[model samples]
Target: MWSEIIGKFKGMPSQEKVVRLLLERGFQVDGQGHVVSGRIEIPHTQIAREVGVDRRVVDATTEMILKDDILKRVFMNIHSIASFKDVAPLLGLGVIIITPDNAQNIGILNDVTSVISMFNLSIRQAVTDDPFFTDEPKMTVITNDVIPGELVSELRKLKSVKSVTIQ
Candidate 1:
């Protein structure tokens, strides 16, 4: 799905940078061609600076998105999410990072959570990096308390997990 979105900007790397940035940050293009995150307008200059492209490149990218029906539909509905991976430990929560053998494999989240549940630990949050955007995608699971050390061995037993680390 992401490849399809990015394929349209082939041969135009600068605009591609803009498109990647917009998708990365979940910034959407409005009908008026403004870059926004749920009603708040984002200046093209700021976007360009982030992606190391010219302001005009961001403008042109959004213009192209608005012109294409598929791109417009996608960008109009995309949104950002809040993750607790970084803040979990700071707030006395335990963090588990799992690097899967194959990110594309299904049921990894459910399987991991099931193992976590057996430990009787309550989950606070779970976030998985998009393989399309991340070079090495991993899953971050936050628990209300530190997980048992023995759980590590159990997690390693799962065929889907390549490695697991508790922080």
Candidate 2:
């Protein structure tokens, strides 16, 4: 999937430079002077220095990448794919409401417990809607073992969450 997106940029005249930039900084800079970070959380300054472009240029590139939803999705998918190798062994999925005041805390707790459970089972799919903000979004998860009935029950206890459904 990552290769396919990168291939899309191959026809561009700046394809080589873009590839080089992406390889060096995990993202490519466009003419609009935007910058994007790669899977490993790249710093803006590092990207700018490597691409031989100013920090402002790198910043612009980041904005450009964000403006294009399709491109942004591709970048995220590529990033997720690249990082999958590291998390492949963890057979667990997570779900959390975004509106909860303790969303972050809940998310962290979910991740930790999920990791622990992954050792005992296999994760099928994990999906979340706006897992960061307080916007009352839904989260979904599917796993081999249901990730312990108690944990889901606990998350549903939060005041900010409207409800919890498990299938």
Candidate 3:
């Protein structure tokens, strides 16, 4: 919602990155959104370039997002973008979970489960609290779709799986 601030620094390099990063971090749509690093400062153009878009596009995106009644309500304060970093994927209309383990497992799980689960989902960090060392070895899974209980029951039948509990 920092569309005005973004518009003020329009045409600057990495403009998209600054606004996107800020929005991702949870800053609201307002002048206060400009106050990121303890001051009303604009980020360098490199940020926009890194995100592969110019500043104007980022500004426009911010404005469009701010106009939404839902977004305005969600980010009431022009807080730092850092707060919203965890919120974007949620906008994808799917459930998400954090495992804190290997990114690869999450990837594989997607391929395996996408067919069964009709919902669109994406994965990042492992959702398992301890993907590595648990009471026993553990694996984390993130999915937007619901898996059939029978599948889980079948997997637990494997010898390698000590126990199955959906965290």
Candidate 4:
């Protein structure tokens, strides 16, 4: 569905760059065709710079999204999420990064979390990148305390996990 949504701007490569940036950052196109994060408007210049496109290209992309009902609905409701991956270690929290052999594999999150629970470690947050959007999607789990070596060993042993990094 995301591919189809983005494909809408297939003919316009500049607009496609804008759309990919918007989707990756969870930025939304408001009714007035403004790029926004919740109620806060993000300058079109910033968006344009991020995607290396002209400001007009960002404006046109939002305008196109607003014109389509499906795109408008999705973008209107989209908002950015705060990731704890950067701050976890500073806050003395455990950070576990699990790169799966295949992001499409189901139960990766459940399986990883189940193992963490077995060690009585509480999860602060679990976030996974969309496989379709990312070249290599990995799951980052922030736990209440530093992950034990035993847990890391166990996680690495999971059949679905390609690699496990404990921080």
Candidate 5:
């Protein structure tokens, strides 16, 4: 599905970057070509500065996205999530980051979560990076209690897991 969406921006690298940034950040391109996060409007200049493109490029990208029915539908419905990985300790939560040997491999999440569950840890949140969007995709699980070393070791032993970090 992502490949198909990206295909539309083929040969247009600036537009591709804009689209990728929008998707990664869950920023929406409205029918009127405004870039927004929920009700907050994001200025084209800001998006262009972040993406290293001109403000006109951001405007054109949003215009193109709004003009396409498929892109419009996707952008309008996408949203950002609040991930707990960075502030887990501050919030008195446990965070486990798993780097998969092969992110596309099946059962990685299930296997890791099974081990976590075996330790009787209640998961507060789980966020997985989309392989298509991120170069170093990882799975972050937030638990109610600090994750034990035993659980981390078990997670590392999973067939799909390459490394595990508990914090």
Candidate 6:
């Protein structure tokens, strides 16, 4: 699905960057070609600066997205989520980042969470990167308390997991 969406901007690198940024941050391209987070409008200049493209490029990209039925549907419905991984330490929560060998592989989350549950750790939140949106997708689990090294080792041994980082 992402491949198909990205293919639409084949010859337009700047537009591709704009689209990727929009998708990553869950910014919507409204019917009027404005970049918005929910109902709040985000200026084209700000988006362009973050993507290192001209404001005109951002405008053009949003216009193109709004023009396409599929893109318009996707952009209009996408949303952002509040992830706790970044602020876990400040909140005295344990953070575990799992890099999977294949994010598309099923059962990775269940297996990892089972291991964490076996240790009786209370999970605060669990977030997984959408495989289509990220090249190296990962799963982040926030726990109520620090995770033990033994559990980290067990998570690393999961067939689907490539690496495990605990904080």
Q: Write the per-residue lDDT of candidate 4 for residues 106-126, one digit (tens) a residue.
A: 889988998999999999899
Collision pairs in model 6: none
Candidate with more favorable, higher lDDT: 4 or 5: 4
Off by over 4 Å in 6: none
lDDT of each: 0.91, 0.48, 0.44, 0.91, 0.90, 0.93
For model 5, the stretches where C-alpha displacement exceeds 4 angstroms are none
Q: What does each candidate score in C-alpha RMSD? A: 1.3, 13.5, 13.8, 0.8, 0.8, 1.4
What does the lDDT come to for candidate 2?
A: 0.48
Q: List the residue pairs that clash in candidate 2.
A: 33-60, 33-61, 34-60, 34-61, 34-62, 35-58, 35-61, 35-62, 91-123
Per-residue lDDT of candidate 3, residues 23-91 (tens digit): 555444443333234444545343456577775665655565466555445445545322222443454
Clashes of each: 0, 9, 19, 0, 0, 0
- Give the local distance difference test score of model 4: 0.91
Best by lDDT: 6
TM-score of each: 0.94, 0.30, 0.30, 0.97, 0.97, 0.93
The TM-score between candidate 2 and the true structure equals 0.30
Q: How do the residues 52-150 of candidate 6 rate in per-residue lDDT, one tens digit apiece?
A: 999999989988988899999999899988998888999889999999999989899999999999999999999999898888999999999988999
lDDT of 1 by residue, 7-68 (tens): 99999999988988889888888899999999899999999999898899988998999899
Q: Per-residue lDDT for 1-167 in model 2, tens only?
A: 44554555565434434444654334543334344343245566776576566666556545655576666664443322122322433544433222334443455436533543645655455545433222455545455553466756665565545565543
Q: What is the lDDT of residue 25 in candidate 3?
A: 50
Model 5 global lDDT (CA atoms, 0 to 1): 0.90
**Candidate 5 lDDT over residue span 1-167, tens digit each:** 88888899999999899999999999988778999999999999999999899999998888888888899899999999988788999998999999999999989888988899999999999999999998889999999998788888888788899888878
lDDT of 3 at 26: 43
Model 5 weakest 10-residue run by lDDT: 147-156
User: What is the Å distance of residue 6 in model 3 from its true position?
Assistant: 19
